[model samples]
Target: MSAWPDSSSIPASETAVANKSEGKSTDEKPSKGNREQIQVNPKVFNGETQIEVDGITVDLRNRYLAALLAWLVPGAGHFYQGRHTKGTLFVISVLSIWMLGFALGGFHVVYASWYPGDKRWHYVLQAGVGSAALPALVQGNRMRLATDERGRTRSDYEPLWNGFMAPPHRPVLESEADEVAAWYARRGSGYEMGTWYTMIAGLLNFLVVYDAFGGPLAVPISGRKKRKSDSSASSSDTGEASAFADAV
Candidate 1:
């Protein structure tokens, strides 16, 4: 045998076989190439997909229903529209403040010389009546617009009520009526203030409603672009196979 593998070089268990094979016929001998190993790259698998969602539109009918209900009753709109807590609170707050003002101001307005039975008391009475009713009416009108079924605003109705179809003109002040009318005029100021206050209050309520129900029709979401794969990296399968052989 010419330079056959030594006992220490070949494993001890294989030494016996190597010596035996060294002296055997070439056709029956096993070559070193038979013991050589090969490795293959491993592959990574990912499971991901892209999808979309349909858009949602606003519901005008529901808004209108809330507004209408509120108009009919002090806070009925909120209540009917599934806002019972706010509706109840608003109705109670307005009514309580108004009634308290009346009670404190006296069932009758106190003036210089006129008694409760005097005609002068009529001015004060009218003032009280207006103060209580004006705010409610103003709020009702605003609520109607705020919660419109068609999502229409107050400006839509302004053309009809504030323009050509407006209510009849105010009565002219005659010369003789000025003195007594002045007192009533002052009294009318109370309703004016009430109207303004109610307008503000109603607007605030509208804001609250907007906060509760406001949202855009819908927004589109785009899918992420695919990333480019690296061309130089070895196969993950080869790594896995080598790891498995090492483990074994």
Candidate 2:
């Protein structure tokens, strides 16, 4: 018998190492995995977009719906998001301005119409207060000439709901100057002031709506200044070149 071990008795692994064979490995290294052993807490995300402003945390939930809610009723989105402080403030500020404007203009400054001479272009801006301004559309439609079920045509400028938000009489039907004079005689400067006030409310609501859709501005009020001052102080302690040193 031969003194050396039989070739059939040698394991393939030892044989490959001994011969340095260029063969595929079998279970030499750990298997590749796509998962991590550690994970972040799921609560951190929780489907809400949160922003910090002035030490306050604002969680905006479903921002698109919040925006639409804010537009329909100023601050409603904030209310939905549980930001009561902001919601109350927005409701008070926006509605107050709108109400004051409506009162000043004899509650008739927000009518919608595209007629010449009294084009009512201001209504475009006023409509930013979504639901509040939508009534004008209804009133305008009511004021338009329509036939009854009896086949009798109603007169133009006819109004229902007590003419609330109805478009003013067609200025071109008579004279633009005459219509202006009539309004001036009725409410003097109140109409103009009210128009501007209501429009301002609408614009402000637009901003609130945006705030609902997107969190507050990311600009830090004091953080940047504080950091800059700290850096400057550190640099000074290190005797680094500064504007004064350059000047000298």
Cα lDDT, all candidates = 0.37, 0.73
- Residue 142 displacement (Å), model 1: 24
* lDDT (Cα, tens digit) per residue for candidate 2, span 60-142: 77888999999999999988887776888999999999999999988888998765556778999999888999989987666
Give the Å shift of residue 233 in candidate 2: 21
| 112: Cα error in model 2, Å | 0.4
* Candidate 2 worst ten-residue window by lDDT: 239-248
Q: Where does model 2 exceed 4 Å of error?
A: 1-48, 53-56, 145-157, 171-181, 225-248
lDDT for model 1, please: 0.37
Please list the residue runs of candidate 1 whose C-alpha ends up more than 4 Å from where it truly belongs after superposition: 1-61, 95-170, 174-195, 208-248
User: Model 2 residue 2 lDDT?
Assistant: 94
